[model samples]
Target: MKEDIENTSDSLKETRNVFIGAKVTPTQKEHIKSLAGQCGMTVSDYILSRAYNFKPKARLTKEEAALLQNLDDCRSDLVKYISALHGMSTKQRMVMFN
Candidate 1:
């Protein structure tokens, strides 16, 4: 019995040490619970996967997909603008700063 107790104490020490708490609305709690269930994971596991960028084959909703596309488009436009500026001669570039 003493050996079993010692083993249990050692096991507990090997487990995670961090704790986090958040105050979420009931709706938010339900949403997170549902998502965790869909992934066959506990809420902690689901949150950990997301927080660590684990890419668990999660699917984005249509709105999220659209927003991501818009962000990509904006990035592409910025790249093109920067490239255009980079290709200009120094005098031509300086003209715009005046």
Candidate 2:
């Protein structure tokens, strides 16, 4: 894990002297910019990633992220409750206990 992190940091800092260029219309430029923004990436990074045969994941909106967190919390709670229930005997789970 540490090695992976170091490699990623090194790659991020790698300098590029070469230039890649393409001509696109105004509408295409706007669309590409919008896509890059959704993925939380700069235009160059976005274009470079696509060139590398991979798509960058779009960033989640605040509400979407919050909902995912809430669902994860609920799933954790459910797991705990299920494990506790599984530890109980059928008699112990009776609803009409004296």
Candidate 3:
């Protein structure tokens, strides 16, 4: 009977809620609940939305930011090298990257 009801609902494109269990610290639970309340969503809804559209938060430490800046400099240097050798044949470009 439950399966028949589920099939009928699926045919109608109606949705039902599903639940899963997760373990987290009390503080984490409180935070999620607070944020979800602000958006008028349940914690589960907020978490599912976040999982579906994950965007990384900026978490750069000072040292990590400096390292990224150094890598950016290296990327700029490589671009300049490639442009300077515009007339170098494809083979030369491949060799330069290698």
TM-score of each: 0.42, 0.68, 0.38
Worst 10 residues of 2 by lDDT: 89-98
User: Which ranges in model 1 have alpha carbons more than 4 Å from their true place?
Assistant: 1-57
- For residue 52, give model 2's deviation from the true position in Å: 2.2
Query: What is the C-alpha lDDT profile of model 2 across 10-71, one tens digit per residue?
Result: 88996767898899999999999999999999999899778656789999999999999999
The digit string of per-residue lDDT tens for model 3 on 22-74 reads 99999999988877776667777678667656432435667988999999999
Which scores greater on lDDT, model 2 or model 3? 2
- Please provide, for model 1 over 1-98, each residue's C-alpha lDDT reduced to its tens digit, 9 standing for 90 to 100: 75675588678886656799889999999999988876678899898777756756556767988999999999999999999999999999999888
The lDDT leader among the candidates is 2
Model 3 misplaced regions, further than 4 Å: 1-14, 54-98
Model 3 CA RMSD to the hidden true structure, in angstroms: 9.4
Task: Record all residue pairs in model 2 with backbone atoms less than 3 Å apart, i.e. clashing.
Answer: none
lDDT of each: 0.83, 0.88, 0.77
Query: Which candidate leads the pack in TM-score?
Result: 2
> In terms of TM-score, which candidate is stronger, 1 or 3?
1
Per-model C-alpha RMSD: 10.6, 6.1, 9.4
